[model samples]
Target chain A: MKLIMNLMASILLSVPAFIASVHAETAVIVSLDNKNTYTSIDKELVARIFLAKVTKFPDGTTAKPVNLKQGHYLREGFNRDFLSKTESQLSRYWSRLRFSGKASLPKEVNTVEEMKLAVANDQSLIGYIDAMDVDDTIKVVHKY
Target chain B: MRIGSIIGSVLAAVLVTTTVQANSGDLNIYGFMSVGVGILDKNEVTIEDFEGEGNFKQDTVLGIQVSKQVNDNTTATGQLVSRGSSDFKTEAAWAFISYQTSTDLTARMGRLRIPFFYYSEFLEVGYAYNWVRLPSDVYNIPFSSFDGVDFTQRFSIGSLDNSIQVNYGRLNDELTIFDENYQSDLKNMAGISLTSTYGDWGFRIAGQRTEMTLDTEVDEAYVSAVQVATIAQMTHSANPTPQSGVDLQAAASALAEAEVVFVEQRRIDQGQTGAILLAQQMNLDLEVQDEFAFDGHVADFYNAAITFDNGNYSFIGEVTAIEYESGLLVDNRAWLASFAKRWGDTTTHLTYSTSRDVLNSGDSGKLQEALNLQGEDKSVTLGLRYDYDVNTALKVEAQYHDEIMNRGVEGDYAMLYSFAVDVIF
Candidate 1:
């Protein structure tokens, strides 16, 4: 009976660790190139680029910010990590832009893999995705 | 069409669109109303033309906005404004689609505010600002819009907040009064605004550029007179057109020719000091020759504000400066200082403010500070304000003007007093 109890206890301890590994998913800022590396961006320029109000980085390179499909986890993660606005307020801001005659809206993709693909292809692109989903095809600039 | 029919059409459309986007009962409705009177003392006025004693007035404004969420990431909003244009007219204040990328980064590709002045964002919603009207001296740029996009991002440092708003768009409009050209060129307009706020202090620096084709018509008389004189000169040089004076005749003819044209064209092109770019080799028609000139302007505006609360009183002061590289009519640099004292649970508050439109530009469009000795120009307004509620107020204002451009003009000083009651809902 003592040996059976020890085996059961050991199984329970390992079960939680297995579940943690199964559910763990990291979030990362996926950009088009090495320019947006975490160590490279100053806090000020990062805010500007993500906000859509800035098109150029501090180094004079143009920035093309993109986002995940609406209402996705990567989208929510982006808000929590970088942008602090709610999705609805952001919509209203876009409405304001439709008639303001400034710039075009950022491109969008439906999934993390799609966003990563787009970001990797263009040096000007900026987007976010599930960190675990990123592969050698894309660069992980900043993760949260 | 009747107002009722217009209402019916809108309601029907809303009902139809509601189904696809949760047309259920998520919609909300709101309205507003206001009325008031003006009591003024017209001191030393002539009763021959008209007369009035203590006037009573009424004003009405109404609007309804339909706002609802289509999903977690998008919302649709539309507003209909009525009787807001002085005349009985209905207009669309805003109608657009909005979608967000994230909480912090969002882009609006439809129509939106150009973010020109401090109060520009809330300019239409009177209740969003202090006073019955925005300080006209600073908030008076004409229509602001274009087929454009707007982007905003906000980040914080320690406890301080920093925000940047950028806009780019093309605009086409005609400016009727005192415009060198009818359009502000807005053809190519884009600007960036950077603002920082820490505690009660905030500062803003914004710059924008506009280019135009300089498609303006010249003063007909001025141009014609020049042409006729040139003709007379060549004729005189060739045939020596015999004048009443070998010397005096020539001078007399020149002066006479100028007088006839001046009398006919009383409204001279006032903005330009002399005949416009005619001598600059612009496109001029031999007979009413029309030429195109290239004129563009870049305006840079900056403002700073400080708000502080002491006990139960709130004090806010705003200072703004607008520098125009070339084209500016009036009210460039202005500063207003206001102090308010609250009483009775803030039901009644008394405030005093002094506003001045200082002369910072060479143009007289800001006539109150223009270098004109004689004219109905603007001046500094020192007024006492009393508010009975958040939406109503009584104000008595007095203005004092000084004439700095009078080399020998008669009246050098002017004073005006007015009392008005303003309300909003």
Candidate 2:
């Protein structure tokens, strides 16, 4: 009886955590040293910045957007949920923009650690991290 | 052409070497390739050379692009593209320098794609669109690029993002028209385009005007038409052929009688008169001269497009119209509407397109038919695109053209089928 009760309790506790893992939140981040007069940003502005439609922040400073390498889960989640674009669609958009000489693909990092480090060092760079992985070195402007 | 092929090979080799050597640098290299096979039910060659037998030479293409960031606000880009339809002859498609003037303004100068259609900028990149190819009816144009300078200004109005682009250019090159080579020059070319987007809906409209000159081939039909007109003018002198003299007299009398009847009919039909009647009287001439030559004539082009895409389903409607002040190339309008649905990794699309020659010469009956130099096309296409991976796509398309009219000859129907594999790296 005791073994069965313990097993049931553990399963009940892990179900929520499993769901949470599947639906992990993503945090759009900036560097801690940045003082661009932004405590939080809107999704539309984020989309525009990443798409290269707007090259500057509200403070009139150049905004350099960074991205994770292709096929990264965090990148995929950020693209779909935040940018509202699938991988194929995003790639197609970039292909059009790049070939037209209108825009270039954002710089890319290989891993989440690298992404965090890159953003923490460059005041102009904007990046994203998994919500749970957010640290003091980065400032989360928005989460989704 | 041979030199161009050598350069293309060198570029390809450089691309391969660079890919193997580096992934992090200021200099960036990009490439795209498509291999295709297509066949048509008719023996005649259509655009892209789809004929009776399956062939792989028409749709195969390879492109390489290299771009270097010259500064924080300036970039230099160069591109080379080779097409199998042109016997795999490579060409430098674009070489340009761009500067970001402001957060929402950019200026570029050098070789640039002619922004005549919605897909003009990225027309060679098959992986950018869902179709195996763009609809031919609306995208038909002889030239694709020009030496130009352009400025783009982007702004927002409420919730809508808008942009306006202005360009000035010139095109001087050798081109093939009607299977005959001609020295073509388009001078004083200028254009403006406006594009706007609101959520899932997108809109664009553009207009361009230019003065053009071309060395046209003198064919037998033109010679015969000139001879007939010359004979009609000299009917009072000795005639070479009695039958032609009598025929000309008969035609003249018939035209006079028809003109009288047309005046009465016009009075009854639209109640139009004065200048309209004079215009109608001018159409009684049996033959028009200089109708096929395009020497120092002004031409205009206009296009409008509306698009909607909400993730899984999309729709597009576009129309293009052209008018030449004087030429055998009559005014024409072409339009297309397409719908696509995506399920998982596959997308299916259906499109309907049509084009017709608009007679502005005021000619009627057989005269109008004789002067029609282009074919009228109405087609329906069904296509499927499968995402093999993030960097590759496989596509199959079938297009059925119905009741196509070339000059005065009408063809029943033609079916073309094609398959392509496109990859980008």
Candidate 3:
């Protein structure tokens, strides 16, 4: 009975950790060259850049934002966690801005590999990918 | 037909160009289509004659946008919209080029929407907003777009995000007023707007001003009456008669005869017997000279709005005022309050709006009375929106309009029900 109770307690404690691992981890990334220039970024700045509200980096360089194609898990996770918006909400927001001729939506890539490649090649480009996909070529500015 | 063909050619060109340029740079094509069926409980709300039945053209609209990023710093965009209210006439909604001047500033020049209200940018895109239609009380501006240049600056203070926009523009268009087509021109149109967001709360304030001129043809009857009144007053002042009342009666009879002949001639020329009957029934007293002209008129519009959203629930309140230093238009004030709650894929909302005219009592005679009769309008709307897919929504709404006052006449209460499908691609 004592052994069974300890097993149940351990299983209950591990449930959240297990669930967390099952959900894909996502991170905001930039070119490795920007790693030194922008060591870290706050959530507001990231949100603004992704939303096309802020077009420049903290160091006053033009920022090119990239987005993942719709229905991508990593993109959805990043939008929900960092921007506090759903895909539908973001689509509506962009529609208003785009139709008004005020702003344009970010460029979208099909896969995480393409995202990483694009970000790695362009110093101004900012994008996001799975946390596990982060490599030395691209820097992770934020993790979610 | 001309507008439609122009839009079609533009769309074809955009499609071909986007396809050809897809591999080189960023070229995006997006569109939204909305169709609604509305039925009024009574014939009180008449729009160009048809009333009291189901109508499909009241809220149907389609808009397509094409954007090309010339480079990292510049973009060109064009949008075409076909509106049912305008009989499915396609027009260029916006055509502009935007340049990112700095990290925080963007400048755009071309034909752009006049940011008159919070929803001005997306007024025709039903999917972007929860309401089947934005409150008509505050959104009833005569014009929606202008050829302009605008600059937007974005900044932040602590936790708050802020954007300020300044615009200069001009508008020249022809519109129908009181059953007569008039050429309207607004020059030196200038506007400024500020928006701020903190956490779940948002605030906005905007103001605009323009110098206007309107040229319209006045009713012959009105012109005759004014002339007769002037001549009669002059004759009485110049030469007093023992039978002055008799002379005045004879002048009034002549004026009435002239009015009758004018109405008869109009009926023959226009073949609008129903309009003539309605005008007579409503006792319309037109108050202008033969060639009605207004020049050097200044108009000012101001608005403020506040909103709060916490994912599942949201609330918005807005107030607007319009002041016109002109003889043809009355000052106006309007306000709206709305609340919505989202549950799962469905959201329900309720809104109440009201508007009133500010009459200029200084003017006497028929004009003052006409302005005074522009009484209050109020409405309550309940709506539901269901996101059926990633980029499509289905909505149903019911609106109740209280008794409305228009053109020296009072309208009865009206209830309108609508169902709409909104899709984005």
TM-scores, one per candidate: 0.52, 0.81, 0.83
Stretches of model 2 off by over 4 angstroms after superposition: A1-20, A33-40, B1-24, B44-48, B217-292, B361-368
Q: Over 4 Å off in model 1, which ranges?
A: A1-144, B1-26, B30-64, B80-93, B176-185, B195-203, B212-215, B230-274, B277-294, B309-311, B327-331, B345-425
Per-residue alpha-carbon lDDT of candidate 1 for residues B1-425, written as tens digits (9 for 90 to 100)? 69999999999999889776664644433333333332323433311111134323222345555655567456565656564333546655555555655444546565555676555654544333334344444554555555577677765565466778887876665443321225445556777777775543556667665554334434555555556655566666776535722544455476577656554431223323232433223432222122112355455556665554332344556666665543223225555555555443231233332233333322222321222312222245555555555444555555444333231133244444445454443
RMSD of each: 14.3, 9.8, 8.4
Q: Highest TM-score among the candidates is held by which one? A: 3
lDDT of 2 by residue, A1-144 (tens): 999999999999998688668797778888887776445467777887887766666666677899999999989888887777788878877988888877899999998899999999988899888877888889888777
* Ranking of all predicted structures according to DockQ, beginning with the best and ending with the worst: 3, 2, 1
* Model 3 C-alpha lDDT per residue in residues A1-144, reported as the tens digit of each score: 999999999999998568668877677889988743445477778887887766677776778789999998888888788777777777777877777776667889999999999999998899988876788889888776
How big is the positional error of residue B54 in model 1, measured in Å on the Cα after superposition? 7.6
Residues B1-425 of candidate 3: C-alpha lDDT, one tens digit per residue: 99999999999999999888766657778899999888888865753222679888878999998888898679888889998877888877789888986657889999888888899877899998898777887888777888889999998776688899999999888655544455788899999999988877889999999987765334556454646665776788788786765677778887777667656442112222222323343465433321113465788999999998766788999999998765456678999999999887888999999888777553222453433335568889999999897799999988888757765467667888889999999
Report clashes for each candidate as comma-separated counts.
31, 0, 0
* Candidate 2 vs. true structure, TM-score: 0.81
- Cand. 3 Cα-lDDT: 0.77
lDDT of 2 at B240: 48
With a 3 Å backbone cut-off (N, CA, C), the pairs that clash in candidate 3 are: none
DockQ of each: 0.03, 0.53, 0.53
Deviation in Å, model 1, residue B324 alpha carbon: 3.1
